[model samples]
Target: MARFQTPLRYPGGKQRLAPFITEILEHNDAVGWGYAEPYAGGAGIAIELLLGGTVDHIYLNDSSRHIYAFWKAILTDTEAFCRRVSRASLTLDSWQKHREVVRHPGDHDILDLGFSTFFLNRCNRSGILTAGVIGGLNQVGRWRIDARFPRNELIKRIETIATKKRRITVTNLDAEAFMRDRVNKLPPSTLTYCDPPYYARAKRLYLNVYTPDDHVRLAKFIQSKLRRAWLVSYDSHAAISELYRKRRQFQYSIQYSAIQAYEGTECFIFSDSLKIPRDSALPYIAQALRQPA
Candidate 1:
């Protein structure tokens, strides 16, 4: 029932926003056009669009080599990756070993580290590579180490994605480089949706965090360098509002869970090439429904 295309359980993933993005793609006459994500950590939204047949192609890029290798493995080494997933031991000891691999990911091969990244992600709380394991070491909590990882179901999702490998492009590049080198080369109809590292707890939550200056540079570059249709999503941080104060913007909220107040609210800024429905207020996309004209 869920559009569970991605195996990675990313914190603050935009799964609920897939419908809104679909609206953006269709409204721009860009349906079946190229879609891209520069900070493709879990790439939940991109995978949903691709698997749901809303986008003809999806570009997924991440600056972290481990993250990139994880996606690269999914697309290129699908069978082996699925095999590893099917047989991965979900014990805390196994998690510890995979954690070591993630720590010194440089020592592992592309596929090995990729699987390890996936392993640690699924086993860790919130899918954060560096976070502690679920249910704690005692394993006496409400959940356990294997609570999130239904290996059988995970393989199905991975295999389903692999069937469309030719339609998915995976890259390892910094956000700025990806924007300039890869996305800019795509067709003009391509629409890139950027979810940069959120504003708060980013340093602790992500492998890479951007400085205030980096965020400013990104905003400037998105406004100036890129000509294709694009949009950026950031937490409703006051600084972000000021950064994109001149651009077309709106407040967005996820209606799925009332408990996750941490990442429930966001501010979206779009390029002048695209239009946000004037009648639509907060929380733009719901259930892949088309927005108002």
Candidate 2:
């Protein structure tokens, strides 16, 4: 089916980062790498790559069990899960009904049930993982099912299906573990798009206790392991800006809001410690980096 039939409703999702992703992929002619997004949420980027046929292999991961479960269901029981989703009326009453329909079915993996539960997640007033579980817990807690199905233009797009032939793997792992441990197991040419938790806003929703130190560690890790792998990261603090600036990397600044609060600039870095691909135009910030600051 279409790599994704629904738009994910998470703060700082790579939905807006799609354009930059295309640019970077195009610039590097990075159309054949094994794609990995350890922080996969809503599978936005992974699905995009699937549709564009950018990568021959895909690996998606999200620490959030709710998200991981949703993916499991879609991949394994696509038709049945879609049927359940389509039959359910998109009202609050229907929400409970659908929840009950899929709730106790042990034939499928809990991850599958979790994937089927995201329909309500996108519209929940709090926009957190509170719904679709038993007792409302934070990201760590179980999910409770509630909320309406997708509607309007976006949902219509999601209903379209496209088949993918590439090998695809999904998991629930911390981003660094996937990069540090998993990358070594892959072929020499693989691409890792890390939409890690935003350093500024939306950090709490992403990780139980993400701190500034985590961001520094992540950057250091990326730089160290980037010799053979290509990576794309979105971060915009001065420290982030300065860290890569020192490495002679290209960084693009874009503005977007998170959690309905508009603030800060998101800086995207294009790095592949390999020789810069010479085919495409230089990245936007390449020339800017040549100049002072």
Candidate 3:
């Protein structure tokens, strides 16, 4: 698969991990099956897997209003969304303008807010909406603000993704609510990918920051409540390691971005029923987090 089938450049996005995920789906004979992501930040893996024909249908949900609006508009109002993207002004001035639109999205329609969010995500550092431009405000840095916001390519991605509107289900729902209301209804053969906010760095990275207790609650729900075959990814942290210490888990490092790129450790926990692959794909050398005691 071509690297980065999605338009957005999300920090810690799992576009690189698509191959490993594909291998897992293949190992389990889950190709052409239903796929889901409850905390669908950028939906990198979901987008690649579905578009590459690894899965026939995919479900994506995010609690963030702007994220939900963005996905909704992209699928439902494809032409208008692409037009908005095509016509976007790529400058520090336009970045500030879009920032305001993103901050006060209630005043505008979903499509407008969605496009503004897209604009900021592309123009800003690490695709973080709250972060600043790709280069400094003076535009004297190595890259300009428009360096990443390639209008034509991004528009093509939007249009292409919109083509699969029928096969994609997008929603604005809490992860717990999504599991209860949406995922519970999918076929037993479905494989759900749960890439939740990194507990160690979520406060700085996401608007919907999770408390320590919230992490515990999510762990309980995933271990006890989620009935279908599911896999979860999280930045490695002691708390998270403790939470899934007894489950089937693997450890590896990924290139994560905050203000800059850094090698960050990550862990993947699989449900009890699934078979762990004998080895992980390249670029992600898997080591056992710990064998279940």
Candidate 4:
């Protein structure tokens, strides 16, 4: 049987890269180690690792309050969370209502906030929370509204995740703060996977934009934990490439169909302690340890 899919459709989710991620985790001996995902967007790869028994425990963290609230509800009250999402109506009206509340959810109840996040994410085109409308004005009917929002499938997925016996800790904190507060306390056996927003598209794709300086800060923090951390980002930015010039890097292309089909280069930066086996699924690119002249 196929591994349970992520309940939400995240724009940059690594669902297709699950096999390669599993291969990398296996290569680095992740079976008994704790797995930490600081930027856990849709958490597709993390869920896969947990379900495949690749890790002993998983720590999921996200800076987005709504996203974090949704995950927190899932971990604390899976049935109620699933019920809230399952019963949500997938209509333009419903989408707008939820979007309004998610935009300012300070006064909303926890379950409402969770449902709002879940609705906006799944109902919005391309799973972009900020993108308004269930289907963009020009792209109405492009998404089979009812068919795409499969309540039963989502509930099943949530149930599967909820039943996993392995420990799961969900936190709402800035990535750096989370690392400082929790990561330092964990054993070196912990393997952290950082999938921050792409530097070039952060402002367009995410609410909390990662500026060049933020990228530098993240790089510095990851460098401190390089012995057990792995970072992924688009290979288009020069500053990012320069930041990890001395580290081991792997480049691969990810192809997906949105409004149109597109393929882009993705880079994985890792410490010298991690090795990419020759037999791994990713098409190996030369290690990126030198800056472009």
The top-ranked prediction according to lDDT is 3
Which lDDT tens digits does candidate 2 get at residues 71-94?
Answer: 665566556555655554545565
- Per-residue CA lDDT of model 3 for 122-238, tens digit only, reads 888878899878878888878988888778888888888999999999999999999988898899988889998888887767767888998899999989888899999998888
Report the lDDT tens digits of candidate 4 across residue range 193-284: 88888877657567787778888988887887545556565646678888989886656666764434577667877766777655655443
* Comparing 1 and 4 on lDDT, the stronger one: 1
Better of 2 and 3 by lDDT: 3
Q: lDDT score of model 1?
A: 0.83
Q: List lDDT for all candidates, in order.
A: 0.83, 0.58, 0.85, 0.74
- TM-score, candidate number 4: 0.89
User: Regarding TM-score, does 2 or 4 come out ahead?
Assistant: 4
User: Which one is best on TM-score?
Assistant: 3
Provide backbone clash counts, one per model. 0, 14, 0, 0
Regions of model 1 farther than 4 Å from truth:
255-263, 278-293
lDDT of 2 at 27: 62
Candidate 1 displacement at residue 185 in angstroms: 1.4
Query: Candidates sorted by TM-score, descending order?
Result: 3, 1, 4, 2
How do all the candidates rank in terms of lDDT, highest first? 3, 1, 4, 2
